[model samples]
Target: MKTRFGKLVCVCAALCLLLSAMFAAGCGNDAHQKKIALVFSHEPQRWTDGAQMMKESLESDGMAVDLLIFHTDEEQAAMLTQAVDEKPDCIVLAGGDIKNFRDSLEKAKEQHIPIVDYDGLTQDTDAVSYYVTFDNYGVGEAMGKYIVQKMNLRTGGGPYSIEFFSGSDTDSNAKLMYQGAYDVLNPYLESGQLRVPSGQSDYAASAIKNWDGKNAEARMKELVANHYQSQPLDIVVAASDGIAYGVIDGLAGYGGTWPLITGQDADKKALGCIQSGKMAFSIQKDPAVLNQKCIRMIKAVVDGSQPEINDVTTYNNGVITVPTYLCLPRIIDKDNLSAVSK
Candidate 1:
């Protein structure tokens, strides 16, 4: 009887220990669970895909993620403020006018919530902890170089009529891209190899507000009607696929042959355009790669370790030089369309 009682007690103790272990495993401690807030200024397909990928990747790693998207600057500022109040471990920001977000960024800074500036948000503030984006200048340089080689600018080709379309005025990346292209093309313009028929060569004159397709479309139509009515436009330097689409739409009404157009962001529609021989070439900046880099940075911040960065002196946010990881963009044309289309 004594032996039986002792064995029963041992069994009960074993059961209690197993139950305790199971309970602890089932109910994960909240203290160790990291949280991240992802904020985007707009819901363009690219941004949408990036947000979804980031959310899934972080969540799969046992981290909580809050995905927030806003349409306008005001909406973004408010969303940022709200995210700061929630006190996530880190904030990943993409696409938005950074001027309106200064106060909210400051608040996040005060709260010790690191901000990962995905893509180029602003170069005028040091509120962000890290930045992950493609080399915008290089993207533009690729476009310019492509045009130069195709047009044989180096071999003293005849003067070609060209037009330019830049992104929104608020985006620093736009300026950087414009500068890169302009630096390459300006010499040609000065040497009479390329001429701007519309006289809209400067960024201030060529910028499309909000990078809106409609605005770009309207501008293109106006330029065609006013300037390209007589002279044929040989080339168009569009800063993005959205602007490129606008240029295409603006030219659709006219019966003129499509000019050699250059664009960024190898969007599916733009790739289709390339396949159809409507667009010349586009710069491919894969959002998946960029988002993965951002996830690594966020995880580093959560783990209290130093995140990996490549370029340090390139991105100057006025207050301090932001540490950045630059992903290189590639040109996608009809020859290689099949590779990226899949």
Candidate 2:
């Protein structure tokens, strides 16, 4: 009877040890999970897609992600402050205006939280560790190159009347894109092959506030009424699809052939317009490519490894040169629309 009782006591002790070990393993897994804070300034479809993809990808890697979207600069600043207070392992920011978050970013720096600046460029570099984006200059160059090829500008075929519509002046990417387009078009403009009837070639003159389609539409109407009444407007270098659509709306009842237009962001409506021959082409910055790069970078930072960087010299955020990964953008036209759609 005594031997049987001792055996039972030993068996119970073994069971308790096993249960404790299992509980410890569960807590270990929980401790290993990383947390991330993702913030976006706007809810455009592309950005929404990016947010979803990033969340899914990070969660799949055993990380917890909090997504925050804001509409105004003030709102974004507040959101960033809140995110910093949460003390996540990493923060991903996509904002049109970065200067507004200077104080919040400083707090993030104090807490040693890594920041990945996505899409939008910023002047704050001390806290921003990595930058992931499609090549803005390349996007502009593609647009300008498409216009040049279509207009036969290099082959001396264009004495075309062209109008320029640029993105918001506040966006750094907008300026880079405009520069890329202008660099390609300037030679022709100097040679009189491309004439700006309104003489608004400068970025400041052509910039649309906040990239608003309505504002672009209004400007397009004013330009058409003032300058294009006699001569045909042969080409339009619109920096984005919104601007392109505005140009299309402004020209609805002008009773002339549609001009060859260049735009960025392969918006669905813009693609339909391309198919119907209303607009020329647009540059598509694939969100999946950018999101994957961001995920890899975020994971690397969380794991205490150096993330992959392709370009380090191009992106200087006022304070320091940021390590950057640039994804190339592709041109989407009627001929290649089905390929991209698939």
All models, RMSD in angstroms = 3.7, 2.8
- Candidate 2 lDDT (Cα, 0 to 1): 0.88
Candidate 1 residue 189 Cα shift, in angstroms, is 0.9
Across 263-284, the per-residue lDDT of candidate 2 in tens digits comes to 8888888899889898889889
Top-scoring candidate (lDDT): 2
User: What is the C-alpha lDDT profile of model 1 across 1-342, one tens digit per residue?
Assistant: 999999999999999999998888767676558999988866467877899898998999989999998888788888998899999989988887767788888888888889999886565776788988999888888888999999999999969999999988878789889988999888899999999988889999999998888999999999888987777888999999899999989996666667998888888888888988889999998887888888888899889999999999878877788888898889999888889954
Candidate 2 ranges with C-alpha deviation above 4 Å: 1-25
TM-score of 2: 0.90
lDDT (CA) per prediction: 0.87, 0.88
Clashes of each: 0, 0
C-alpha TM-scores of all predictions:
0.90, 0.90
